[model samples]
Target chain A: MNALPAHVDIREVGPRDGFQNEPETISTAAKIDLINRLARTGLRRIEVASFVRPDVIPQLSDGVEVLQGIDVPDDVSLMVLVPNSKGLDNALRIRETFSEVAIFVSASETHNKRNVNRTIAESMADNEIIAKRIVAEDLRCAAVIATSYGCPFEGTVPLRHTLDIAEQFAAAGAVEIGFGDTTGMANPAYVGEFFTAALERLPGVEVTAHFHNTRGQGLANAYAALQVGCTSFESSFGELGGCPVPAGSTGNIASEDLISMFHEMGVATGVDLDAVIDAARAAQTVLGRKLTSHSIIAGPIDWSPTADAPSCR
Target chain B: MNALPAHVDIREVGPRDGFQNEPETISTAAKIDLINRLARTGLRRIEVASFVRPDVIPQLSDGVEVLQGIDVPDDVSLMVLVPNSKGLDNALRIRETFSEVAIFVSASETHNKRNVNRTIAESMADNEIIAKRIVAEDLRCAAVIATSYGCPFEGTVPLRHTLDIAEQFAAAGAVEIGFGDTTGMANPAYVGEFFTAALERLPGVEVTAHFHNTRGQGLANAYAALQVGCTSFESSFGELGGCPVPAGSTGNIASEDLISMFHEMGVATGVDLDAVIDAARAAQTVLGRKLTSHSIIAGPIDWSPTADAPSCR
Candidate 1:
């Protein structure tokens, strides 16, 4: 139980995942500063920025500028999200600057259609082609399977359908297979069921539990994944990332809050808790509004809530 | 493991626990109507009002009139809170009207002084005398140990001290026991561990967990208690108790939220879920402020939240 699978790798997704959701465009230096501050916090791996079309996610348009500006460490495994061949082409142009490039495929046909205008099977085929190209270019490929827990359109994803997609990614030579609870509806009971099933069915592939705090059950669900032996987690720093389905709401859980809970529970997350909170607080300033990360406002669980942290109305 | 405690007797403390905190003197007809409305909703046990001096708890000064006005059903157990010998004499006068009377003692000595101006020993002595008097009069006595989780003045009450006080009540012949998380510091971890310890220490004594959602963990803590097999929970219809320690703050977990979670988890609480929510909505007109219960304003969790309950500003 102590040797739990992989030891909770909080693959920091705030810079990329969080910034992509903000309607307001942040400055290039601010994006680079967010990553540099995150790197100093001892996060071994982070999704630095996405190479998506400039017109689509206007916030992350300065992706190359951010990467070139930040003095990121060599030991840090930097990755960026590639949506399609065009995004991958942009990544390859700056391939020398990063360690790995990740590709995402939706488990649900409805989501895959809305996400990247492809069916589930079409996305899988595209991901296979992209995975091979990345591998051939001497880069590691990690497959991010979105909506593994459930889909916003369809109530619950069939466990077998999600597992089948994971199997395809593992068989196609993915270094890691991450499960995304895209809608933030994954309960602790379901997390235990999903991961326990994955561990038994897909033993070779590493599992990452990425969750959202939409219903405030994100931390509980993460702990459930931990109990059943998952070591890697994906979260945004400031609990950022808007849900594509639920208009005007969040997607992933906050890295600062996740790390704080792990630290308080005596679990190793290999993240500097205070530095991460400070990073998220920096994010709050850039976002121009208070975000939902509990650690930033409540401080750590160990720190008794002083009358500080301007109470939210 | 799933055989959740059936019939989680929700001793409605709204009349007594609710009104005691308000400064204004509510009419006796309002109290009678409130109790009668709750009685129609299948609540078997209701803490109708408290018997104490006007100077001590001025809001409950018309406790005698309230008891006489309300139509008491034969099967439903009506309870009244008594402070000391004088309160006991007042309660004794209404002994013919009600079937049960609950006497509360503090687990923390410091809280006992601040709450009732007595030490644990003195409170126990008074409780023991009241406990015997209730039995002699052929009325059920439920000795509630307040601040069972943690005290405001004194921080955590050790499990041993809590069990010792519970043992005293059991020995003094209390038919049922209630535990109050008076300061709302009780988290799920504490509730589970304490309830498990209490069950092992005092084998057959019925235990009820009373918690406050001051930190948004009250309902979560109650669910944790159910996991460890303690079912009988006492929640105010709408969060209606006032903490003497923290003036102008929340006191108890919303009863409707507790019912919602229990029903959602498929736990048989034998409480009419919809009726409880309706009762909470009804209280808005009678009590004249927005309720603290989430399910009250937001509707039952299954009912997709079209509107969010206002934040306590």
Candidate 2:
């Protein structure tokens, strides 16, 4: 593998991705604090909120309110999920505030049907309309294809299917593509080999890996992706959003865990590890529960002696 | 990496590796039943029991009785631990019964003292005596070097220390050199790179990877070793074994979990996934507690609705 990039981008998705799966309603002020806390942790990109209707995802209904209320940083880029042009327009209305806009299309035909109640073809067609609004607002468009590896409903998603989704997104003016292992079926070997193949199929495509620790291979798969030279990755603080697959499994690789792994490997991520841990600990308080993060429970790599230091929880 | 080996050896240490951590005096009947069940799983090599003193590791003290009583198949080679000549004499008394004898050594000076109450120099000296006795008894000798990855106290072990242990084992005519990640600090990348380097340094060495999932990287580390052409691995059923490094930490990467990963990847481990899951579920019943196994809780790959009807767990 070639030498790694100058720096890795850690997109914190705690507020959006973390809370979305919870069966509780987090108040507006609490989410604003979460976003602010994440910003203070030296994270350059944080997926702030999703523009889905409140009826669909009650947890993130205050998307517009959250967008307008949170204190925005100048250098840190804020991205929110927009389901369609309507969500994109709402995202566009707040476009002057945030830095980037992200739109997603499910790669698996079965997942597309279950997720957005549309066919795989419909999701791609919807992205074109969403991309138009994003480009008009002078915002970077990131097209995320969920279930790019294997789907909960559909066992194995062909590489061609994922690449074609990328091709369609690129055609629709998306500047970047993020692959999501919605189910934790993607192994490191498969991810490494596939990413290498995908690079060949679509040159100059900036790919981001959004992996869930459903089966505990998220970080390993991330490393495999890194080995194939894809650096950008998305993680949730405290590993909040769990596997939406039928199992209610663990979610995206915990942000604290991922950052610790990267920093341990001597790679530059520019994220303040201590600050990230603090934010995740506070998130635990907000949720009124302990998260599935090892770093949070075990403390930092240098943690010792007082390993039994008073419990933060 | 080239194609995986057509056939890989799986040494069932559940009798030894799986039982030692369990907090119960598993009836000699239950231990024998565990062995009887495993021998039927078609595993050729099995570490039947350890010859440690009864007062120290009380669980396996009935080692000789368990070995002498099990209705073992001839093809299923039996092995036991020999901590010293006393342990070796226990093996030699049953030499007509058991086929091979395994001995323990530590790569780190401190770990050796902690594990076997022997200094580094002292363990090597014991190895020469143990190696010569086993060879004379017409028994195969497997030298397990504990804490080759990182020490709980000393931290990251020097590569030279581990190689030195391997060299001594080779000189002692050890039939196999089983590297133990006793501290659970092994990463797949580290395992891949370490074994690659180890193979070059100690050609014709038979290596077995014994990893603890203290940090949840055990299976990943095992896979990396397999990719690097090291096939034999040791895992505890129900993911037992407390990591000496991280206090109260549950490592060992549950045997069923490892088998599940390989089975799903179409890697022919010659293991029955259903039987293994049944075995793990049985282990849970024996322990009288819910064990942490992703494969057990999440079921198996075929647990998906899209797949065939759920097989018996």
Candidate 3:
């Protein structure tokens, strides 16, 4: 295996990606509270909310309130998801609330059309404009490519197609490009191959990996990306953020789980595992349901001196 | 990353390992049925039962009945767990019923004593006797070293100590040695290091990996094992078989989840993914609760022609 990076950047996306998929609407107060909790956990970036229309996603209708209410450390870069030019305009109205804005387009035509009711070309055209505007505003612009691995509607998306879209975003002045395994369809072998080519194709871009535990390969895929020296990642606490269209699909790889693995492997993430787990617990209480995070059930490895003599299993 | 093996052998240990930890007592018929189902799933080796005292583990007291009742294909090898000479004697009475017998000892002294009320030396001495008996009878002898990665009572078991135990077992006419992560304290980096040394030291024995999802690192550890050219693995269906001593620890890496990953990575396990999922589903019905296998929740990747146009996430 390739040598792993000593440290990696983790962006917490639970408030936006996680809450938007929940059936019940999370109050704006709770959203801000969770975001604040995450920001203190040594997480450098937090996607606090999305600028999607309230009617389209009622659960996140209070996005504006959440973005305005959260107070985080100066080092934490707050991010908001902007789907189109109109959404960017709404986010720009409260320009100081967040330091980064993300624009997304699916790699597959079918997924792109269904997700935003626009063809891949149309979405790319709009995102180019959006990316330019975000850069003009002097805020960091991140481009997310959904279904960069495989598409639920279109299986086995070609690597060339995904990289082409990433190249376009990189040329359009995006500082970072996140390849999302939107439905947990990625394998470690493919992840290794994809990121190897992606890093080579897009120089100087912060290539990030975003994975889901929908089929339980999330951490393994993350490990593969780490092997290939991809340093940035995005995850949701409490394993939230399932694809709403896939009935049985689960959530993004839990942030606490990712941190636990990285810490165990001696790769620093600058995140406190116990603090993130606390945030996950808070999420469980807010959602009033048992979340799918394994770390939440089994707390971080007890490293206390007294814990060394635990009874045998 | 190291090139993964083209094919790997998986030993299903759910019956003995999983059922013994269950709160409910499964009927002999149900155990036999599940064993038969697994046998047909292209799993060549299945640990069908254990010969522990009925009073100690009532769930598997009907080990003899289960071994006798199971009907499997000719290529399937039935295995039984034997704790000591006494257990092996009981299993030898129905020698024709099983093709392999496993003897286990924890690497850590405290864990060895706490688990079976015997010191490591005592357990090893008894297993030496059991190994000879099984070999004399021309049956396959497999040795398992519990707490091989990290002990719950004793943190960070030295790789040398665990490998020393494996060497003794290999010298004792044992054909296989399985290193177990009893409490899920293993990290992928450590796993890669452990297996690299193990495979180098034990040249002829089939070195197997047994991991728990207690901290949600099960599959990641398995992937690391694969990357190190370790091909033999033991897993439970429906993520069964957790350490009962750890209050909140979860179960083994789900068999279906492992197979799904291997299949997706273009590595073959010879197990039918759908068939194993069916068995996991049956286990859920038998247990009367939702199990934690993600493949059971999302099903396998839909590869049919019509699935190509799935609605976007």
Candidate 4:
């Protein structure tokens, strides 16, 4: 087995990616409260909201309110997802609210067209401009390539297609690039190969692994990413966030579960596991339903001598 | 990343390990039906019953009936769990029904005592006798070491303790040794190190990984075991089989979920993915509740060109 990195960074995306996919409208107050709670859980980065059109993702229509209402420490960097030029413009209006902006495009043409009603070339063109403008504004610009592993419509996506987009993002001055397994089609071996090539291709840019637990390979894929020395990650609290377009593609790897695995493996994440679990429980309460996070249900492993005796089989 | 094995063997333990843990009494007919279905799913080994006292695990009391009722092909091997000399005697009454018998002890003294009302030495003494007896009768004998990773009561069980137990099982004529994460306390890094050493120490005996998904690290731990060239695994269908004594120690790694990861990683398990999934769905229906296996919920990734287009984020 390969040696995993000593430390890793995790960015909580549940507030934005998770809430936007929900059918029920999360109140602006609830969203703000959750984001505020997450910020204090030792997470240095949290995606607070998405600046997409209000009519498109009504669940996240209160992005402005969520951004304005969240309070965090100086060390915490707030990020908001920007869909296009218009979304970037809206986010810029509340420039003081967040420290970073993320722009996304699908690696597959069919997914790109369905997501943003544009060809891959068109989305890339728009995102290049958006990335440059965000950098010019002196804010951190991050690029996310969705369906980087495989596309629901396209099946297996060529590896070069994703790397090409990342290269463009790096050329456009994006500080970080996130490769997303949008439909959880990624396997560990493929993840290992992808990150090995990605790290070599993008010298100074941060490569983030964003995986979904749709097929239950989320943590396994993340482990592969760590094995290849890619340290940055993006996850949702309580396994929130699913591609609403796909029927079974639900669940970003739960933040607590990911943290639990990292901590147990002796990798430092600098996040409070119990605190994040509490925040997930809070999200569960607000949603009025059980969430899919295992840590939220199991809690962290109790290592104390007085821990309960397990039933022997 | 380390190279994983090209081919692996999986033993379905849902009927014995999973059903015994359930609170509700699954009918004998349901168990037989499920076992028969699993036998046809390309799984060569199936643990169909346990010879523990009926009062202790009334759910699996009809062990004899199930073994007699299940119809399997020539290649299918039936296994039974035996607790002590008494349990082995009972299993021997219908010895022809199963080809294999498994005896177990915990690496931690507290867990072993709580589980079987015996110290580690006593259980080992009894199991040594049982293993020799089984082999002498022209049957295969396997050994399972519970709390092989960490003990809920003692916490951080020494790796040497588990390896020593495996050594004993090997000396006593056991053909295989299974390291069980009885409380879901195993992590990937530790798993890698443990399996690496186990394979070196036990050259001829098969090393198996039996993980619980209590902390959502089941698949990740299994991945580590694979990286170290440990090829055999024991998993329950529908993520069944949990420690009944420990709160929140529920869910063995689901067979379908583990198989899904393996198939996606290009590892062949010989089991039909869809057939195992159908069996898991059947378990869910019989149990009258949704099971925790992710593959059962998502199904295997549909690779057909006519597969449904996923929703765009």
Among all candidates shown, the one with the greatest DockQ: 4
- Please give me the total number of clashing residue pairs in predicted model 2: 0
For model 4, the docking class works out as medium
What does candidate 2's lDDT look like per residue over A1-313, in tens digits? 2444556888998888888888789899988998888898889899888888878888899888888888856888998888887887677766677878888878877677777889978878888988877887788888888888877666778898789889888888888799888767777768877888777776776878888776556776777787677878999998888464535567778888788767756677999988898999998998898677766765554523222322100
Q: What is the C-alpha RMSD of each candidate to the true structure, in Å?
A: 6.1, 3.9, 1.4, 1.3
Q: Which ranges in model 4 have alpha carbons more than 4 Å from their true place?
A: A244-249, A307-312, B244-249
Per-candidate TM-scores read 0.75, 0.90, 0.98, 0.98
lDDT of 2 at B187: 64
lDDT rank order: 4, 3, 2, 1
Q: At residue B27, what lDDT does model 2 achieve?
A: 86
Write model 3 residue lDDT over A32-100, tens digit each, in one string. 899899999999999888898988888888887887788899999999999999999999999998999
Stretch of 10 with least lDDT, candidate 1 chain B? B304-313
Q: Report the lDDT tens digits of candidate 1 across residue range A1-313.
A: 2233445787998888778777788889888888999998999898988888887788888888988888877788899889877889888888888877888888767767767888888888888888888888889788888878766555557889998998888787787888887765566656777888988888877788887654445665776687678888888887777353344344677787677656644578788888988998898888789775545664543323232321110
Name the weakest run of 10 consecutive residues (lDDT summed) in model 4 chain B: B242-251
- Tens-place lDDT per residue, model 4, B250-271, is 5689999999999998899999
Candidate 3, residue A84: the lDDT equals: 93
Candidate 3: deviation at residue A120, Å? 0.9
By summed lDDT, the worst window of 10 consecutive residues in model 2 chain B runs over: B304-313
Which sections of candidate 3 miss by over 4 Å? A303-313, B305-312
Per-residue lDDT over B12-126 for candidate 3, one digit per residue giving the tens place of the 0 to 100 score: 9899889988889988888889999999999998998889888988999998888888899999999999888889889989999989999999998878887898999888888
TM-score of decoy 1: 0.75
Ranked by DockQ, the better of candidates 2 and 4 is 4
